[model samples]
Each structure stands twice: as structure tokens, then as C-alpha cells.
Target: MDPGANWWEALSAIGTVLAVLVSVAVAIREVARARAAESALEDERRQRLAEQRRGIAALVTAWAESQYEPSPDGTHYVRRVIAHVANESTEPAFNLNVVLAYGSPLIQLGPLSIPVPIHVLPARQARSWDVSPGFAAHSTGVGQVPTDPIASISFEDSRGVAWTRGYDGKLQEGGGHQAISPDSETGEAQIGPLDSPFNPIAVVTAFHSALESATTVQDLKPLLSPTATGWSALTNEELVALRDEHAAYGLAAHVWYPTPRIAYVRLIHDDDIERARKGDSARALVVTLVFLVGKGWRVFSSGGAVTEPDWIKFPRKDLLRDLRG
Candidate 1:
């Protein structure tokens, strides 16, 4: 009856089908495992790159001189920028280049085309380059590169991997990226953001401005904290008087944030230069202000007090401590 032949043939056919199915299932599992492994590798690469980026903390600062230079265009207040940079990093940076940026309200445009000379800085070392800002020639109004200017800088690690950072001059990290072009001569590689801080002179300038420009109590209100632990901003009358007296001000060297919300802005009364000498006249005073969250910078200290902590007594020592080498 050929029974044995049929039964054996059917069994053989079934075994072959089972073998092919098993092969396909195993191949599918292998493909999935490969994809999972590749995804893990990509994640690990990202982590390693982040660690590399953390090695470099390049900072640029805007240090305004006490004496304000008169710009040919009297409408603008121009000041010299002692653009300083330091490598607070673990590695050496070479072929380092710094460029001053110009734009209104950061994140709008990119960096300016003007490039400062390149230099080399090692870890923990700092170097200074001078730039005069607010000049209509170099910077364009809207207050010549807002108060917060981008000091776009780039450098290659000892290994030649290029990195770029856009320092907003206030120590806040702006745009930064890796895998930048290594060629310094080309016009292709440039700083990230071209935005500027509206007030370049920092809080003290802002304070002096509020004082100089305030004509009435209503005009002076925005610059002061009417209800604070230390209501120390200039009295409405004081602000009006300063404007009338042409009260010149020498911004204090340091703007310290005693607390995140509270900032201490110190200034020397230069209305009478000689009288403002260390012990002469009022000498110096501080205004403690509160930083209104998401609104703006520190609210003017309430009292309009003319005295500061022990720090202000020694201007040379406390001035520009944040930018110190």
C-alpha cells in the first residue's frame, strides 16, 4: 500500500518546514539584537562627547574703564572693552581666536565679522585683549551691541578637535558647538550668536542712567524697590538732583550677587572727581537691589544708602574679582 513511503515522506516534509521556520525566527531575533546594540553604542558616544565638552570653560568679559571716552558721535556713549578670556579648563587651547559680536537682544542674529587676534591660552591661565565698544564704527546702535555682547571664541584642544563657544560677557554660556572648521584663515567659521546686552556698562551704568535720566518721581519709580528690606535706591528727589547736577558716576569695579535675587551695585560719585577720592566727599556707595524673576535685573536697593560693606572700602582689591586671574 506504500503506507510507509507516504508516512515517511510526509514526516520529512514537516521536518523541513519546521527547520526553515526556525531559521527565519532566529534571523529575526538576531536583527533586533543588532539594532539594540547599535542604539546603545550611539548613546554611549553622546555621553562621551558631553564629557569632552565639559573640559573646556572659555570665558570672555567686558570690563569698562572708569573714564568714559567721548565718541565723535555724541549721541552714543562709547567705552573701551578690555576683552579678557581665561581657560578655566583641564586642557590647553590653541589657535584661540576671539571676536566681538553685535546684535540686539541675543538669539536674534549671529556674531559680527570682526575678528580679534588669535592667541594661545593654557588651563588656568588668562589673557587680555582690548576693544573699544559703542563706537559707531565698530558697533551699531541699538546702543552699540547691547549691554550683553557676545564674545565668540573658538579653539582647538591639544588634539586639534575644534570647539566654539559664544560667551555673553556676563559668564552665561551662550551658543557652543563642536566639529567646527579648524581653518582660522577662512571666513566660514565664526562665533555662534551675534546678540548684545542692551546695557554694556552693567547694573551700575543702569543705575547711573536711572539717576541721570529721571526727571520726576514717576520717571524714577522703575529703577527702585519701594518696598524692600533695604529700600536703597536713590530717592526720587536724589535722582532728579543728580540729573540737574550733572552727577558723573564711576561705576564700581564689582557687581556682586549676595543672593541670586539680590545684587549689590557699587559706584563712586564722580560728580566731583577729586571729592570722590577714597575718603573725600561721599567716596563710594552701594545700592542693594532685588532681581525680579523673569522681569529684569536687580530692583534698586531701597534706601539710597551711601555706604557699602567692607568690600567697597578697598576698590582695587574687590574690583573685577570675577575676572581676576
Candidate 2:
């Protein structure tokens, strides 16, 4: 073979090797570019999911606070909540669990420090988990865990009157007066004539009679003493308004006049009050009798009004005095 031909052959082989190397390099670059795009998409997806989770957390917090109210048994206030979790990945999450930390009023369950078992629904379906009737003693935190490993973790505080987390966590208050009880007679005596047989049962009966007799506001006027400042405060228009409002709301009076001095009656305007004492916004129209030097036990006062001290900013006793004057 000619030397020149051999040299040309060697050059052709080198050119072919170089073309192969160039092709391999191009393929590697394409793979790298695809991988980079995929990574960016994953990051974007994660960010969106995090944002959605945050929004859900906010909504859950609001729902919880709205439901929180004083228990009617007057023992405590309760807040209950349900949260929805979504599966963001293509693979189904298996045995998914949540870790909950109870900080202050929120106490953690022992051993696992894990959240209560939450039912796993389908990818788009939702599941619910109850956080409490949790007491006002502690704060709450929750974290989500998926069986398959992923890079995102977030947590939120579940305590506060409003939907934000931080030092604002306060104990929810009971609605009824702490001084009064369903069966309590002593506290009932303080408001009315102690010597009169105006206990809860008696007062309820008297109010019922008054309500039955009340064809007009004027007829009901006789049940209240002439000296009663509360009744006097009501204008004729206001009285008519009360009657109308009460009638619309199904207001009914029950008196428990056990003794002349102590009386207890519930003026139920709606069924809401029985569900929660906080709904007892309707005036109870209590009548208390106090003894005087010249007079024996008589109706000390009528149309009694009681409000939750926390909600009522003004001093009720002072207001009462001003009305009397």
C-alpha cells in the first residue's frame, strides 16, 4: 500500500473518533439541560405547595377560633378544628403521619409525640383531624410527614384568639357569671330581697304569669315595681321593640322564686342559649326583693340584666347605680 494512502486512512479514523466524542458531548449537555429544567420545576412545585399549606393553616385557625366558646355546663370553653391535607406527588403517600407538639395550653400525647391517627384519603380527597376541646393552658404545633422522603417541612401554631401565632394565646373565658350557679342559692340572694321567697323556681313562675298577662307592654309594667330604674329606662318604643324582638326569637320566661329574697329565672329568647350560655344575650328579667325598715320583703328590683364581665367594658355595678340615681 502507498504511504500516502495509509496516512489518509489514519486521518479518517481520527476524524471519525473526534465526531463520536462531539456527539457524546452534545448528548451529555442535553441530558444536563433536561435535568436542570426538571429540578427547577420541582422547586416551583414545592414552593406552590408550601404556599397552599400555609393558606390552609390560616383557614383552619380561623375556623377553630370561631367555634371556640364557653361550655354551657359552665365548666370550660372548647375549640375544635379539622384540617385538609393534599398529596402533591405522583406516587401515593402511604402510612402518612403527622407530628404534633403541644406547647402551652396544648399538651402532647405521651410516648410517640406523634399526632393522633389521621385517615388517609385519595390523592385529591381530604381528611380530617381534631385538635381539641384543648384547654387554654398551652400552645400547639403541627408538622406533616410523608412515607416517601421529600424536601419540604413546615409547622404552625394552633393557639390564639385570632388566627396568628405568638404570645397572644389567651385562655377562653366562660360566659356565665362565676358567682352564679345553676343550683346556687347564695349568689342569687345578693341581687334581690333575701327574705322573699324568690328563688329560681318561684321567680320562673312569677315571670311566666307576668308574660301570660302581658297583652301589651303596659300590662307587663305592673310586674315591675314603680321604683325599678331598669324598667323606667325603657322607653315605650324600646319596650315595644323588646316585645317584638323577643316574640320573633321565641323568648319565653321561666321563674324560680324559691324564696322572697332569692330568685332565679332564665329568659330564653332562643334555643342557642341552652346550647351555649354565651348565647344567653337576651335579658333574663330577674326580680330581686330586698327588705327595708318600714316595708317587709318586697320586689327590690325587676328586669334584671346580667352580662359577661369581660365583654362588658363598663363597670356593671356603676351603671346600675347611675340608672338608680
Candidate 3:
């Protein structure tokens, strides 16, 4: 055999092997590029879906209106908070429920903070519901003072996607159905609780009886929880003011329970009837009694149109004068 012919065969074999290596490299690069494109498309799809979900929730809005008024039973004063929800989008919202939650430090009595479900909210229309019948103010012994009246709301958009609108008005996906209770009745959302361990009405009556019999502020100390806001370190001036208040109001005329753990005692004054006859029906003091888990029921707070001292920002003397009136 010729040596040059053998050399030619060797060169051809090298060329075939090089071509196979280049083909394999090209195929690998193509596969990597295809995978990167597919990943980018998947990310875009998820982002678009998220934006659509957020947009649907953003179209729903909620606000609240509140005022001090007599409770439904005409027994005691209560701060009635009405929640107004509106669906601005053309699509109706479904399973629209509102959960009135206390942030912290404020004790929720019974199931008062349960979800208030509104089956459906029509598009471009607004509806209002009283959400604060069993709500309590700042606990004299517990957490931060209650400020914002509005609570967190949840709903489902037309596409059946769950969404939550927080108290801060930010809309987010999921958490919409977390507030719904399995035991809720099939009809309208109820305002009051069905069961509790203690009777708040009887507790309030007993508290008032003890309050009326006390001859001095020191004697009244036992009627309050030891953890009450200023009850432990009450100044001499504060004691005198409380004594005068007790002397003027005497005892509660009527009592009502906003929850199984809270009672509102109506302390009608001497001239309250005359004031009411004159159309000034907001003159009496409403003492709040809260049931503590280990300590039972005690006076937690009090307020009136004239002597709402915590909210009035008035001097002590002026507050006492208004209390007497």
C-alpha cells in the first residue's frame, strides 16, 4: 500500500471526528437557549397573573362611620361603628366578608370579632353594616388604646379569586376565606354571640351595687381590677374626683351586655330626664365593666357626653364640673 494514501485516510477520519464534536456543541447551546426563553416566559406569566389579581382587589374599597348612641335595647350608650363597602369595578364581588379585629392589647369578648359575611356585593354599589355592637374600647388594664375604627375586610372577585383588603387599605391575594367560621348560620351575619361562660348583665348589676355602697374612693378600690390604667397609683385628686362622681351618679338604672365579657351600665343623673325631655339625650355616664379571666368582672372604663374625660382633653376641674352637670 502507498504511504500517501494511508495519510489521506487518517486526515479524513480526523475531519469526521471534528465535525461530530462541533455538531454536539451546537446542539447543547441550542438546548440551553430554549430553556432560558421558556423560563422567561413562565416568569412573565406569573407576574401578569399577580398584577391582575391585585387589580381586581384594588377596585374594592371600604371605610367606616362611627358615633355614640343608645344601644338597640335602649339601655346604655354604645359607639356604633358602621362599615361601608363599595365595589367600584363593573364585576360583582362574591363571598364578601368583613372581620372586625382589635389590633392588640384590646380584649375581644366572646365571638364578637367574628367574620361578618355578606354573600354578594353588586358592582358599582355601596352597602353599610353596623360592625361595632359588641366592640370594646381601650381596656384600662390591657393593650394599646383603640384608635382606628375600621377592621380588615376580605372578598372574592368575579373570577372566584380570593383577596384580602387590610385595615390599611392594601389589597393582597389569599387570606380572604380565613375569617369565615364553619358554624356561621346560612343566612345573614349575626352581631351578637351565642354562648359564653358568664352572664355580663348580672355581673354589671353586682358591680354597681358594690359601687353604690362604697362611702369613699378607697372603699371603691375593690370594685376595680388591680391592673386598671390608673387604679393602682391613683392620686389624691383623682380619688376625690371619683368620689364626687360616685356621689352624683349613685347607681346604674339600666344595664346591657354588648358581649358576654362586656357590660354597659347606664348611670342616669338627677336632671337627665329633664335634659332628655328637652331633646338632649346624651347627658348620662355609661360605666364599662369588663370580665377578666381570673379576676371576674370589674369597672374597666367610663364615658359620657359631658364627662368623657379620656377623650375630652379638659382639665380635671372642668371635667368634674361637667360630670356634675
Candidate 4:
């Protein structure tokens, strides 16, 4: 073959390879552009979904407020913390729960968590629930500083999707579990009185009725522990007098269980402890009932007089310390 003919053929082959390379480069660019578009569309879809989820959860909101006010029973003034929940949307919120908590690094008498369940909250309305029962009234000896509490709320939207708004007020889906009624002092879970004999109020009521008929020290001894100071101090004559007094007064008892095993009771004529705070002219009987493992409930400590408003101690330091653990 001639040299020029060979050179022309070589040049044609190089042009063919260049054309193929260009075609491949164009294809790769087009594929990359398509993938980029798909990725962007996916990101936008996710963003929309997130916004929709947040909108559904944000319909309801909750906050906490604390104030010094009359207790629920109208006995005395207490520093009370209440949770306020509002459904701002036109639709009703279901399974609404408000929780006021002191999270982590427990403060004095803290690591406190109070949960109140409101089965349903009506549309465009608000509701309030007591998170703490007269903080000063219940927590008598506990340090009262750092009383500010954070609140979290959980509720179900109209679509039956569960959501939680945390302390930061950020909305998230799928709350772990609902909090039912909780103990006031210990924040332990308790269903209402189930008619069991172990119910604290029932046991105290029965004990009160039994004490009213006791005629002698021997009769009273069974009602109170031998180690109780009140038991040691009561004379036979005093016991008879007390029985007669109980018969005449028929005092009502307000019981608080600091722990399952311990009860602090306020024996009052009515809900009014104000009468008792007035220099013993009319005073309330403050007693402690301890549940002995096999023996049931007995008056562990008695004859404590609440002659002053500050003197009424329900959740004492020792009990709170025990609760902290």
C-alpha cells in the first residue's frame, strides 16, 4: 500500500474512536443529570412529609404554671404546680397527657415526674391539671428553691397517630407509652382504689373506726405500734377520753402515702386546717401510719399537733430522701 493511503486509514480510525468517546461522555453526563434530579425530588418529598408530620403534632401544646393557692380540699395555701394543655386546632386531640418533670441531676427533693392523663381535649379549648399538690404543703421540709419545672405533652391526632412534644417543644411521632394516674408524692404508678384491703385510705378508715371503741390502753395498744411515742405516752384514762372524743367529733382523715409502706394522715374536723393553726384552740391531729410487713397498718407516730400552718408536715425530709433513692 502507498504511505499516504495508510496514514489516511489511521487518521479515520482515530476519528472513529474520538466520536465513540464523545458519545460516552454525553451519555454519562445525561445519566448523572437524571440521578441528580431524582435525588433532589426525593429530598423535596421528605421535606414535605416532615412538614406535614410537624403540622399534625403542633396542633396541641402544653406548658406548666406554679402558684400559691388554696389546695384542692380547701384546707390551706400551697405552692401548686399545674399543667395547662391547649388544642389550638379545630380538631379534638385524643389521649392527651401532660407531664411536669425535673429531669436528671436531681435537685433537692427532685427527679420529680408528675403525669396527668386527659382522655380527650376538645377543639380550640384548654384544660389544666394539677401536677403537684401544694408543693409547700406536701413537701414541708424539702428545699423549695429551683421549683421551676419543665413539661412534656403527648397526644393523638385525628388520624390516630400518636405524637409527643418534648420539653424543647419539638414534635415527634410515636410516644413510647401513655402515663396513667400517678402517686402525688412518689410519682409511682397506681390505679385508683381497687377495693383491695391493702388500700391505704380504707385501712386508715377502718383503724379510725376501731380506735373509737377502745376502752383501755390494752385496747389501744393493738391499734398503735409499741415503739410509737404516742402509744408510750397515752394513759388508760387518756385513751378512754380519746375514744369518747372521737365518738363526739367523728373527725375526717386526709391521708397521703409518701411511700407504699408509710402514710401521713391529717385528722381534721373538716377540710379546714385553718382552725388547727390557731394556737391549739382548735388543732388537727397529725399522725404517721406505718404498714408492718405482716401486721398491716398501725399508727406509727401520733399526737403531733398542727398548731401552725408551717407545722403541718406530710412529706418530711427523711421520707423525701428515701424517695430520692
Candidate 5:
């Protein structure tokens, strides 16, 4: 064979070997890339889980600090959290279940025999969640919304007392009334009382009566003497705004009265110092007062009314005489 031919053959073999080496190198690089991607995905998953645990821990701490205790079954507790969601959402956007679970430390949702699984779904906005009923034998008292825009949701037990979950995963009485009736002029209808020691139904009745006689703010002023603090605290601008708002709605108070028998008052009682410091301490007596002019019944005031007479200074002993007809 010619020496040039032999040299060409040797070069061809070397070229083939180089091509094989290059292919193997390319395969190894691809494998390494795939492994790296898998590792990154795992790291991300672990990070998400850690964040979730941290969130759960924070919620539990808040509940515990509020003095909430786990249920006898060791899995359930009641606490109040802001139900953050649009009024029209189909599902709750809060993760109350996880919060409850972590906060209660050992409470289980199953033994509670709730009909639906309490779920808190993520809201459209960050840092908010929707609350609602979850899987259990009965409704969890989380998702129900009131029909009226001004009305708030409340829960009632078989004994007719209203109930609500506190921030610490414990059940407590709610501040609002379950029902209100406004139409009866005789003040015999059932309604929740306002927060003051004064009866809400009575205030409403008096206000309604005074409003019927009032042609201006001056006329309305005397009727509101029972809730003088509420009125006095209002700025002139605020009163003007209120008047304008009422005028736009063609609203005016005529006669207001509370149902003497059905109105009940609730007092707040909790030993949690943090809750009180957080302004969570609240006592309310519910009374339904009907306003004749509005042809509606309102849950008078969640906060009770206080009497502040401008010119009269009567001792507590003579107060009854002064108010007596």
C-alpha cells in the first residue's frame, strides 16, 4: 500500500474516535443539567413547606396568646380571624383549618363531627383569606354571611344564646343579635339591645317618637339625649355628612322603641390580658329598636348608650326620680 493512503486511513480512524468522545461528553452534560433541575425543584418545595409551617406557627401563637384552649378531643378550638374576601365569593379564601389545627396544638377536625371541612382559601389580595364552613357533621359556623349590608353574621345555639369564635380558638358570645323586628309601634316586638346599659329598644322608640316631631336637626337633638356621647362625639362635618347621606336615601327617624321582653344584653368576660390590651375586650347588650319613620328595625347599637344631659346634674340616687314621669 502507498504510504499516503496509510496515513489517510490512520487520520480517518482518529477522526471517528474524536467524534465518539464528543458525543459522550455531550450526553454527560445533558444528564448533569437534568440532575441540577431536579435538585432545584426539591429545594423550592422544601422552602414552600417551611414557609407554610412558619405561618401556621404564627397563627397558633396568636391564638394561644389570646387564651384559647384546645377542645376536649384535643383537635378543635374556636377563635376569631378576619374573614377577608369579597362579599360575593363562592368559596372561603382563608385557611382557618390549618390555623385551627396548629393553634389548638392537638385538636383534630374529624372528632368534632363537623359536616364540612373548614377551609380558608387564599384571597385575591395577599395577606387575606376567606373563612367558611368545612367538612364536618354540621356547619362550622364560619362561612355564613348576612343578607343585609349593614348586618353582620352571627351564630346561635339551641338555647337561643348567640355564639361566636374568639381569636384564641374558643367559643364565646357574639356582640350582635340574631334577629330584629321594627314594625310594632307598641314596642312589643323582639329585638337586640344596644351596648349601653340603657335599653336599645327604648332608645329607638324614643328617638322615633322624637323624630316624628322633629322638622330639623334641633328637633332631632332632644330625642338623642339618651345617646348624648355618640352624638357629642360627632364632628359638625360628620353630622352634616350623616344628614346628607340620610337625605339622599330619603331616610328620617320617626319613633324608636325597644321590645321590652326580648331584648337581651351581653357582657364581655375574658381574663386574657393581651386580648384586653389589643382592645378585644367588648361587652354588648343587644336590643331591637324599631324606627317608625324608616319602617325598619335595626339592632340598635352594639355599644350601649349613655345619657348626658346638658344642664341637669342629678345624683345617682335622684336619677330615677328625674327620669320618672
Candidate 6:
């Protein structure tokens, strides 16, 4: 063997090793770029959410402009109503319109409407007009929208979304609200306290429903309680793991309302980490299994054994008090 030939072979091997090192460096760079891109995306989402919440807040006030006297047991009933709008927001509310929807046989109305020209309600301002040909009446309690009213109030937000109060006393968003006994009243629809469209129980159920049928966990983001921490809003890694695991075993869950103030949720199936470590998905596990009704129904805490859900021992409280005798 010539020494020169050996030198050429050695040079060729070194070149090959250098090429391999370059390829490795490029691969590592690409991975870092991908991670940075994901981090930026997550940051953008959080920023958008924060900005949206900071936009504006508006709701119809529930101050009783009542006309009814006390009950036999001396319970002051709210029969008359003054449907009004209040802006408890920093952002001025514009393009406001309140529509009244009613039904016949069960109720009666042609639908009354009130519009604000140059429509704007300054922060801490309110619109209180005698909206009572007859709004709904609560036999008892504060400014209560009637469940069995001849007509119901539907209104629009500056965001171009129409909403009505739900049975759970939260606003439900659609385009319009359907009055009780939808005979001729069918425009937009939402729930009310008499028939809540998305109660704490329902909101929790919808969250699980999204997990059961959604491609992205972000769909469950809106349902998460504002106070939720840790895994409630999963980080990128947790989300990926869940997506991978859930693909293997179709996830199913249900939210049960033990009380208006509390909700209990349980996962029927999921690839829980404990089970995965044990090489089994047979045992059921918790996926945000408990919810308490805060301002809205939100995930209080999650993760418990399906066999013995220690959290189920708690009691539920009534969020709304019906003083109707």
C-alpha cells in the first residue's frame, strides 16, 4: 500500500465526518427553530385573550323596578319591570339595541325594540326605561327576569353578537333570543334561568364534549375557569401528550351538576399517565373531574382515581336563591 493512497483515504474519511457534523448541526438548529415558533404562537394566543377581555364588559342590570306587593307570607314580589342596559366597562358600548320577544297561547307579543342612536353607553352609565307592558315576574327576589314571561329581552353587544340571559343567570350568545313557547318568536336563541342553555353543568359538559370530539384542545379553552391553574390549560407538551394518548383511546366524559354552585365531571376513558406508566389504559382516571360554579362554570381541580373519587364526598350549594313562596 502506497503511503499517498492511505493519506487520501484518511482525508476522505475526515470529509465524511465533517459532512455528518454539519448535517447534525443543521438538524439541531431546525429543532430549535420549531420550538421557538411554537413558543411564539402560544404567546400570541395569550396576548389575544388578554386583549379581548380588556375590550369591554356590558350586561343588563337586574335592579327591580317592581310593581307587585308582598306575598301572603310578606315576600315582596317583583311583578313590574324596567328592562335596562348598564355598562360596567371601561370601553364605551355602542350600537346597542334591545328587543323584546314573546309568544302566544303560552304568551303573547309582536316583539318590541329600543335602539340607541349614536349608540353609546359610557362606562358606569345605564339605560333604564319602563320596559314593562309586562316583562317576566319573579314571585320573589331582586330584579328577576321572568321565566314564564309573556315576553323576554334580547339585546346586541358592540361585537355584533346578540345574547339573552340563561336559566343559570348567565348570558348565552347566539344572534337572538327565542321567547318562551316559540310560536312566532324564532330569531336568535339563548337560555335563561327558567331554561338555561349552558349552565355550570352544561358548560362543563361542553368542555368534555369538546375533548371527546375536537381535534384541538384549544376548543376547551373558553370553558376553562379563569382561576384554573396547572394542567387545566395544558402547556404545549401536555397538550401534545394528551393528543397522542387520546388518539389511542377515544376520550369520553360527562359533567354532572350536583348543585347549581358545584359540578362533578368524570372521564369515561383517557390514557392517564398513571395508567400509561403501568402499561394500561383500562383503569379510568380523572381529566379535570371537578368544577365549581364561579362567575361561570369553571374547572376547579382535576385528577383523581375513578375507583374512589375522593372529591365526590363534597356537597353542592345553590348559587341562586328563589324566594318565591
The lDDT per prediction is 0.46, 0.36, 0.56, 0.56, 0.32, 0.45
TM-score against truth, every candidate = 0.34, 0.25, 0.43, 0.40, 0.28, 0.35
Error of 6 at 8 (Å): 5.9
Please tell me which model should have the higher TM-score, number 2 or number 5: 5
Runs off by more than 4 Å, candidate 5: 1-209, 215-223, 226-245, 249-325
Consecutive 10-residue window with the lowest summed lDDT within model 3: 186-195
Question: In terms of lDDT, which candidate is stronger, 1 or 5?
Answer: 1
lDDT of 5: 0.32
The digit string of per-residue lDDT tens for model 6 on 1-325 reads 8999999999999999999999999999999999999999999998886456434432442232336655444556434444456777655555554434332323232222133231667767876655332232112135744343332334455565555553234555553533223222431222223223233334444554566555554666676644445445576666656545444442222222233234444443544534533434454434443333333445555444331334343223422332232
RMSD vs true structure, all candidates? 20.0, 19.0, 18.5, 16.9, 18.1, 25.9
Ranking by lDDT: 4, 3, 1, 6, 2, 5
RMSD of 2: 19.0
In angstroms, the error of model 6 at 127 is 1.0
Residue 107: error of model 1 in Å? 18
Report the lDDT tens digits of candidate 1 across residue range 1-325.
6999999999999999999999999999999999999999999988887556544543322222223455453555445554456776767667665544444432211211122234467777776533332221223445443454456565666666666664443322233231222123332212221232222224445556676656665665555544442334447667566565436445543233332234455456666444533324564556655434223333444234623333222223322221111
Supply the global lDDT for candidate 1.
0.46
Clashes of each: 16, 42, 1, 0, 55, 9
- Per-residue accuracy of model 2 over 1-325 as CA lDDT, tens digit each: 8999999999999999999999999999999999999999999998887665444443321112114555445566544333334443232333333322232232222112112222232333444433321111121223632111111112222221111222232212211111112223332322222223322333334544565435555666534434445665666677565555444232232222222122233455454545424423443454443322222222434344532223222223332221112
Q: Answer with 4 or 6, whichever has the higher TM-score.
A: 4
Q: Which run of 10 residues does model 1 get worst, by summed lDDT?
A: 107-116
Query: Of the candidates numbered 5 and 6, which has the greater TM-score value?
Result: 6
Local accuracy of candidate 4 as per-residue lDDT tens digits, 1-325: 6999899999999999999999999999999999999999999999997777667568898877777765455666646566577888877888776655452431122212222356778889986655453222233243645445666777888778889987778888889343422224443312113243334444555556777776666665666644455567678788776666554332332344443445555565543434543323354565566545445456665554422323323333322322112
